[model samples]
Target: MRVFAPLLALGLMASAAHAQCGGPFPAFVKGLKSEAVAAGHKQATVDAFFSGVQQDPKVLKADRAQGVFQKPFIEFSRRLISKQRLDKGRAMAKKYDATFKRIERDYGVSRGVLLAFWAFETDFGGFQGDFNTLNALTTLAHDCRRPELFRPQIFAALTLYEHGDFDPARTTGAWAGEIGMVQMLPRDILINGVDGDGDGHVRLKTSAPDALMSGAKMLSHLGWRAGEPWLQEVTVPADLDWSLTGPGQNLTVADWAKRGVRPREGKLAQGGLPASIILPQGRKGPAFIAYPNFNVYFEWNQSFTYVLTAAYFANRLEGSAIYDAGTPEPGLDGPQMKRLQQKLAARGYDVGKIDGILGAGTRAAVQAEQKRLGLPADAWPTMALLNRL
Candidate 1:
């Protein structure tokens, strides 16, 4: 039997759509109801799932206001993996040792990796967001930006509700509609849910074991290789070809060694595993040789900074030393990055959008500009580069 949270009185917050997108949110939801029924969800289930659902302007606001992806890797990683978070993550690993052992045995995922993901996702379950999952998903689905992604999540949530995964009345989570300790989206839960406690049901909200195990299952399905290093901090020689850096360039540890790449604080292990040298903040900041398992982090989160932070946090949990390579130099902030991107595009470098993110396209363009300027072409954006732009 599912134990539902105390029901809050339903009240409609005035839609901010009129001020923003002028979307007919209620009518969109009505169409979703018909679509849900057509997609084989019972009418009663559809109605119940959407009961008291509202257009969460805050959710839409957050969706449109995602600027963190533009943050430099050093700042982003520091914020996500603080000393307090690391200590608490270690404690949690000890507290849940047996459960983690079982999870590793069953799913072949590292305990540290799982704990790092959990800590990063929800602060060790300190607080999952309070937004109603149904309303958030509905609003996002109705919003024109990315309906193709959120619409499927809505169906998955409805299916979870229909099957009693959680009480629909209490289905609250992040504004993006990700739920529970590790913040899995509804579709992820539907596909990778696991009864980690052997309770014959997967309840992520109240069960750390269930959530961690389910997350592990998902990671494994996403190609997480057990006992493989995700990334290793390394020092790259100044004269080495800068084009060899980034995810696209794959080489063995031996090949990297031959190119003057060495472990920052330790000896590189002898292996033939192909790895990519990633200079997250260009050559001025830390460099890391990312292994095959690092790709799984991309599968977990598309943001380059986010995946690096998670992988680095996991390494810290396993007692790895902090990175000893170059420090992040003063660099361009979001607006400056946007200006630089525009400059690069005007120069016919195709830096994608002037969205302020130093993604691959923007970075590549920065490299091209550096080469044209007769500067070291490390592909990292600096305030100096922005000023030149």
Candidate 2:
């Protein structure tokens, strides 16, 4: 789930009779209420759900100011993965061993993967955010920036309300409206929620079994392989063809071994699983060969650095060694990154926004440019590469 600063202000406004997405906050909420009724919700139910829900300026501010993802992989990973978290994750794994076993058997999702998300999302349920989920969803839906994504979640939450699984005023979660321990959106819970504890209710906030089983089901639906490895650190040949790296350039493990790519520990994956070498910080830093299972991680979170950290954390939980942090060069700062994005956009590379964040689209464009300029196409943009462009 996307982290945000704690709620700073809870602002409320009078509701309007008209419908809109942006403009007067009341009108946008009115529009949402109408939409909910049009989608078959009872008017009373819609009213109750929208009652006391107000536009939270803090949620909007938090949504627009998500700069935490800008950190490089090493720094980001080191910051998130700590010894206490590791110990807690292992203890939770042991505590919920039976549930985890059932989830893995039925859903193909590993315990470490689920535990990693659990630890990261809410510190194993120590704190599941304090934002009122309905208000957060409505406030985000009222904003035009990403209304299409958050608007539907509002109605899904209404469904939960009707099913007696949600409380419009009492339910609390992340600023982005994800609820419970693993911080799933309402729509995801509607589609993949499981009553794992046999308590007849999918209480993700209170029931660890419910949260883990539901998360595993969601991951399985997202194409998680039953018993396949997701990521493995590997040593690449100094003269390896870096242009052949990145996500789309997958090759068999046998082929990679032929090119002198060997695992840092253990043997390769049967020499048949298709994998790609990813240089998160260029060839000078740590390298990992990502298997097809790793692609499922993108379905969970879009931030490449976050996904890599999470996947690597899962690998570590499964007894993998700590990745070797090599002496890699520093990345571009905000202004430099924006300038590079502008240059790439000028060259017809759709880098999404000129926001100075090295997102997936920008990374892909950088790799293409690097290949075109006869530089190492490891997809990690550097100053020299930027200067050449």
Candidate 3:
């Protein structure tokens, strides 16, 4: 059985979810309260949790406005990883050296990995978000787009509320209801939260150690291999087959090395480690060899660009050298990309959502179409590829 099986069973109940997710706001909250009580939560607790909770249109707006991720890898990474963040990450590492050491020893998650998330999620706790947590959860749960994913989080928050950790009116966080410095969902907190400071509560908002350790524990649950390398910038041979590139293809580091892929700075991982050479831009752009541990990043966030940037930031925090941003071919804009996705979908390819984002499904389809068209299958969609399609 999965963790939180009883709660998860309630979360997946279509009858309750359809009534709660499809009805008017008042009816939705009523159904949710009824379901929560039926799922073993006390009536008083559920009522207090839902008291004054209202749908947040702002959260829905933020959910739909993810266009910032459309930026190219170089642009996105540069925008997120600043000199100040780098220096702050180093200082924060030193400040919490003891806690990080304990976390590394117990969880096998490096400080750099946790620090990168800390820096990105909320600027090292400078801003944990301002949206009311309960309202955000209720808003998302009531929305029809992705109610299944958000419904369980409500109960998890109620669990925290019962433990006197969460405040329905005062607990504020990201628009998506992720709490604390590292922006973890409520379910993640209930499952992987760590009391790093040992004050008897997993306080992620106010305590740096609590947030850092909790974040590490969550990453560990996401399949992060302890003490394993995740990403390394690399140089590829001019004669290497471009068709073998992209995150979809994996080969041993030894195999990649034989194909003339060399590390840009430090030595590569073990020869036996399975790695994929990902060209974030195109054949001429920056390249990196992502190891198995890198796959776990997707469990935290689905955006490929964000995951790559976070992995690269972790490397930078550990003193990795800057990557060479080779001159890559220009990619399509939002409209052009949407057109490409439509074309790919019409061709019977599952380019999910057709949302103009170059997600994994779209990239996979692009690679397949590129290979079929006798073009370099680097998986970076280009105008040429779009025209051919």
Which candidate ranks first by TM-score, i.e. highest? Answer: 3
- Of 1 and 3, the candidate ahead on lDDT is 3
> Order of all candidates by lDDT, from best down to worst?
3, 2, 1
What is the lDDT, from 0 to 100, of the residue 373 in candidate 2? 94
Residues 209-291, candidate 2: write the lDDT tens digits.
Answer: 99999999988878888988899999999999988998768999999999999999998898888999989999999999999
Clash pairs (backbone) in predicted model 3: none
Cα lDDT, all candidates:
0.79, 0.86, 0.86
Question: Model 2, 182: alpha-carbon shift in Å?
Answer: 0.4
User: Which model is ahead, 1 or 3, in terms of TM-score?
Assistant: 3
Q: Where does the lowest 10-residue lDDT sum fall in candidate 3?
A: 1-10
Q: Which pairs of residues clash in candidate 1, taking residues 3 or more apart in a chain or in different chains?
A: none
Candidate 2: regions farther than 4 A off: 1-20
Q: For residues 158-255, what per-residue lDDT tens digits would candidate 3 score against the true structure? A: 88998888999899999888899998888888878888899999999998888888888888877889999999999998778877877858899999
What are the runs in model 3 whose C-alpha is more than 4 Å off?
1-20
TM agreement with the true structure for every prediction? 0.89, 0.93, 0.95
Model 2: lDDT to the true structure: 0.86
